[model samples]
Target: MYYADAAADNSVTAYDLSSGSRTVLCNMHVQELTLYQEKLYFTCTDGEKRTIYRMNLDGSDLESLASCEDLWYMTIYKDVIYYVNYENDQYAILSMKLDGTESRILRKYNASDLCIAEDKIFFAERDTRYLYSMNLDGSDVQQLNSTYSRCINYMNGQLYYYGSEENGRNVYSCDLNGNVTGKYTSGAKFLMLMEEELYYYDWDDVLHILPLNKKSEEENTSHGTNIVSYKQEDVLKPVRSYLASNWAGYTLDEGNITKQGNTWIILLSESGGSRQYQLIIDLTTGKITILCTTEDILPVSVYLYDTAPSVSPSAAQLSEEELNSIADTWYEQNYGPGGAWCFEYHDYDGNGTYEAFAVCGPVMGDGYDIDPYNILEAILYISSTGEITVIEKDVRDTDFCVENEIEKEYYIEYDGKGYYVPHFRSGGILWQPMYGVKDNKPYDTGISGHISLDNDGDLLYTPNSGIFMCPECNNHVEHKHILAYDETSGELKSAVKYPSGEIVN
Candidate 1:
């Protein structure tokens, strides 16, 4: 598991579950440690500026992406960076290309707890604290719920958030359209789901667990899985003995302990020295294993993938008909009949050869609504030798639309290469997939890219003047509001278009 240690030297560390080994990737004040495409993206300080940096998983190639004074809640959605920026005590959500170029504000609201899923951005307005969602372009904004909510998260087709109700704080569930589904575990916050169970911290900061499959929140589960806490003696006895025998000269200071399944991971440091060591203890058998001594094992540099797959410059090309046949044959051989399938081809990796985006599942009935059928979508990588492979599979139809809609591309420079990344439209929702080639195989990186589109289905970019005027309203009495940024505060402001076709703030 990869975690940021804010309290200890402000470092980012990775712990191996099986070996109980720890590797401190970087020793810097870090926040939002997101690992994408074998690279680690995090927010840290560059002097007084809050900056986002990208580095290898092993702490190499540390490059700064962007820096600002009032930036927080940095997250990557489909390779596009979404973050909250505050200026003049006003909050505005902005997005930027992964390379830190093409920065634009999507919307201006006092927002917090920003999350993105299913081609929509979810957030909580700071003043009302209500849940709201909007299209990737910041248009068609909709309120998801009225109750004050925070800690918003998207999971498994539902939005889970901490809702403040009249009675008490409860973890609530709602659909993407703002309809309430269920409420579970009252008086709890920081909701998280793992292994088909819900884990939360209560008012007293005590951790609790509830099985998701249980009929109600009242159902009970085994204490071993629910509240897995160990007594101090269970940890200190073995730790004290190991420390005294190994580092008798140093005095014990403090230790940070975390648990995973049946094992306990403890990091112990000295009082006045820089010595630090890790202890992995099996709670089941009470056997303690020393992971490393400060002087013993430092992390070795390792890349996420030793070799990334590249397209052959002279690869054989396929006609559209030939590509379809290959995808159909693979689908039949794997799924074995009954389901229908189709393919959309694009050069996802910016390679000369076009990769296939395949969608296969139970045939859909007329007129929308896919919840009735099991859908599976995949990205197919075909070699020059006509060998077919499924690079990424089981993508939900709701994500990358499976419909026959017009395709658009967002052109941006990445890794010094210009790519017209394909964006697909389904049911009026548009999304793009982030692709990575690892070990000579291509796969969806699970990072999505969002692009703003005008009503005419063209890519919408920030105007050169940083001001927007409604193109449709000309000499009309209806007042149309357009977005503009304040010159002094850099905050998003609204301008009204008048009947005379003149716009004024």
Candidate 2:
């Protein structure tokens, strides 16, 4: 069993129920627990910091993920972890990949106990108690109902929730469209909705299992757990034919299609080591577009099987001269003729080989461009073995380009081995390297590019103050104390302000 004993100790512990042994995986105070594919991800607090951290099953190799003020109510589905976080001062629904990439605000409202089903995210608001859902990519959100439900769970194909209706609190079942199907039972001090049984304990602490239908307990054990095998169903031959006819010579995995507005997004990949494809199709126009196919593998002292040469081994490793030759060629191609470029020299992956980095573009072109021509871009890491891994993203995003300036505004933090080498903590950039505190100065993130310290000079993780046009209010919103980073301790720290124009430790 994996859980957090926040009352006893602010720690997440994994227990071997059979052996009756437990190990504390982390020291942070957890609000939730999730175990997926031998990895544990949870939201926790260290002082004022509200952040997410991921670790291996054996309680080793822990890494910090995304952080925000008022970060709470988190859950994961597929590769994305959804949570309620502050976006422009308003607590809103947001999501990021397990590695803390692709962070986006799904909707500008506080939601809790999120459950994903039928290709959509479902949650309820705490204030008004309205149930809502949206597409996986934070699009096409809709209010399902106004039922004041909590501890919401989805089983089979229906939604089960606890709420009050005429005579008091009860467990009610609702369809995907949010219509009441049936009331299961009442009195839920604790509720667990499984595939075969609904278990709950009352104020007396007596656990009761209410069987929904006839099923063996063995089958019930396998239900609603992580790592379900993707049982391949028969696909329409025409759909397979369309894929084979279009991609031609590439074997496609099972295609899952979901609609956002009028565009249908089909997410699958070629059976290659480079997990690099986000394919999309439009049902209304029958148009197909290859949206994103950027390279993903980091060439280092480590080379994946197919990308490696069987004979020469690392013998044919490109010399710095040869790598510079390739970098020069790419630079001239991107900037057009006689553009002198110098790169930061380091093994960004820390794999004993230098990656010739350059801020070159037209690398990823956005389809939803403002002018469909070109956009300012960022640096690309050229490996010693001639593979280029994108430092920021593997694909083009207009909105991301607007917010993050990859070439300059962002800084790199390594895994504590090398000075300039970058590290990817959980496959995303290790640290969004904070503006560190300068020598005896009030550091403003936007101005000095250094983090501000409290009077104690302890590291802090806070969002730099800025303004962005709010989609909800149509007015600019001020970004508040985001999340702070403690570089010395390599921990996520929250900022506490004092009346004397100071921050706290």
User: What are the models' TM-scores?
Assistant: 0.44, 0.40
As a TM-score, model 2 comes out at 0.40
Which digits, one per residue and each the tens of the lDDT, describe model 1 over residues 275-316?
A: 776655543223455545767563321111111113221233
lDDT of 2: 0.52
How much is the lDDT of residue 216 in candidate 2?
41
lDDT of 1 at 316: 39
lDDT of 1: 0.60
Query: What does candidate 1 score on TM?
Result: 0.44
All-Cα superposition RMSD per candidate: 23.7, 25.1
Mark the 10 consecutive residues where model 1 has the least summed lDDT. 300-309
